[model samples]
Target: MPAEVDLKRYSKRFANLKSKKETPLTARIQIVGIGDDGLDGLTGQARQLIKNATVLVGPSLLLDKIGNTDSKRIVVGSNLQQLQQAIKELGDSSAVVLASGDPLFYGIARYLTETFGKDRFEVIPHVSSMQLAFARVKESWDDAYLTNLATQPLDRVVDNIRTAELVGLFTTESITPAVVAEALLDRRIDYFTGYVCENLGTPDETVTQGDLQSIRTQSFGSMNVMVLVRRHGAADRPSGSAQRRLFGNPDDLFLQSRPKRGLLTPSEVRCIALAELSLTPTSVVWDVGAGSGSLAIEAAAIANKGKVFAIEMDAEDFALMIENAKMFDVPSLVPIHGQAPEAWKELPDANAIFVGGSGRIVPELVSSAIKRLTSGGRIVVNVSSPDNLVAVQQVLGDAAMQPDVRMINIARGQYQLDRVRFASLNPTFLVLGQK
Candidate 1:
């Protein structure tokens, strides 16, 4: 009896020693991405992590892999608010969350980290469905225009795809391949071949390839990415040779007001304003006196996810800006209908500023806009008359340094019986200032 008691104590002491030598473990949230193949396809580390988890949280499709649901589990569906509540209530419990592909790549990792902080969790990722689709098609996706159709508007996604060699999209209940194909065809963008990769990484995975017009006629599964490769010499080699054009695209392409014709801020002026703005992909811009929102719309396109406020005093021009934004497929333009200075009061500090029109209120507007601009923000003003141009230059020069001003005169070629005539547009002055 005494010998047995001594052996038990010795065993307990050895167990404590072994635990102390091993790495420390804690209660944490593990976000894992799984493919369609299910359990048999999970990595060894992923499998062990799931089996040892005290609490599991995921969608129904992922929950099926556990084989036993007796453990404390939370089923997540489309309710992000509910998911957040569930996670918050989990307090002190070790949690294992299941997601669809790489959690960090448009998955739950961002939300979890944002809500619970990065130190509170660990991520175990699987092959992303997009990666699998690209693999199935035997193509590298390093430069592919990738975005989730679930979160982005159809027009924005289509516009981004318009200029890309390949596109990978995470689709949802509404935006499918047929719908996407129809959109591209409607835009007269029929110069490319299309491919749809569906149910990738699973046994029933399939890849379908056809021209944009041909693909429009067929239907595809829910999980898919519409890939496009431009055909040889498709339409006029796209405006410029990728070096980035400084000015003058087709005027009809922009959103312009009806009765008040030629209200669009010309492309030349727009380029100069953008240059003065010194825009980055994330700079927030405010286009005061935004006529037809030409400057604001282009600024939004250049600043991708950044925000742009298109403040216009005219109702007709405001509506036209909305139409133009939809046509350009730029999502960052926020159209605000009101007079400047007063309208800009509620907006966040702007990184760049653009003021247009030859109105007498130019000086006051410039002063008000400068106050709201962040440090080092650039401002550009456009004027049509020499008088207004001189006024703007004086105002800007007094507030900051010697302003850089330019006179822009553009002429388009028109075909005649035996020659080309120079059809001239309006001449304008662009004044750039900084604070």
Candidate 2:
């Protein structure tokens, strides 16, 4: 018995030493893209590869769908480390990894190929679920914004969806069609016709369609894709329902009681001022001396995810500004019915500042607001008189690339007896300072 035990110990030591000296596995992995239809959906070549595989690795759901395979199978889950360790341990074993839809389209193929050598694997792709969803909806997806809910936060995704003509989303278990529908409705984005496609390519497959309000109340199967199609002639904003003009909306769209008319910024100047602000989607803007909130309202629309504070002392203009914001469905615009320099004391620092006034105080207000602007922030001021313009430019300082100054002289087109005439507007000076 003692002699037999010694012989076994010697044999184990020899095997261990041999394993340490041997090279790592060079076996190639076959990654097959399969649909919900399982093996029935795979091509003949893919089926043969799986049949010949010595080891198979995939999600348990996919593995179950491809049941009774003669190959040794390893189930992959959320644990990426486990998957990598399993592959490393499968030395000299030819393996096949199955994934859903197009393997490279937000699937396991990209991860696997990155972890292992790309040259060590072969990929066979099927139609992606996102493609299938758009196809089922009969929509062209060339320019459509596509995102995966599993990867991106729904809040940030909703902002992009606001302006997107078409959006295709891959739904996750926690963030489902119902959650997305509710989010859209909450943002007052009601123009899209929502589609929920579930269990695609399977016998129990279903495609559900409804408006945002209707879809908000519904549930869906775990495996699904949600698509949103913005209706024809729909503006990129809910405010478009009331104020449909793209950028420099007409001043008449705003409610300026009796004598306050013509106090709002002209469409031409509004466009110029907005462009100079260099605003992003989440830029915080301050429109001081905001009469009827024309520039502030438009800025709020452009910075969809940002906040805009419209500071006006006039009660009538302040009320008008509030009404105009709601009229344009601009939920991000906050009407501050007090004077500036003090009204903005408690508000957050701004990214872009817009000061509009014909008086001397306009330049000083712009100067004070500039102090509150964040680094790399922008400030644009529109002064009607030449003195205020020069004073504003002086406060902005004269760096080589510092301030941008422009004189805006606009004219309105009019027709009299089929003859065209132009009505000239007073010359206004604009100074844009970047800090």
lDDT of 2 by residue, 1-435 (tens): 454567788999999998786665587888899899999988899989988999999889988988797899898886889888887887778888888999888887778888887987899998888888888999999988788887777876887687677899988989989899888887677889999999898898899999988888988999899999888755333322343665788654566554345667988999999999998889999999898788999899988899988899998778777877887788888889888789999999999999999887876787788889998998898988889988888888833226779999999874322235787988898898888
Give candidate 2's error at residue 81 in angstroms. 1.6
Index of the highest-TM-score prediction: 2
List TM-score per model, in order: 0.52, 0.56
- List model 1 lDDT by residue over 22-86, tens digit each: 65544578888888777777899898888887888999878986578446789998688988988
* Clashing pairs in model 1, backbone N/Cα/C closer than 3 A: none
Worst 10 residues of 2 by lDDT: 234-243
Candidate 1 structure lDDT:
0.76
Stretches of model 1 off by over 4 angstroms after superposition:
1-26, 236-435
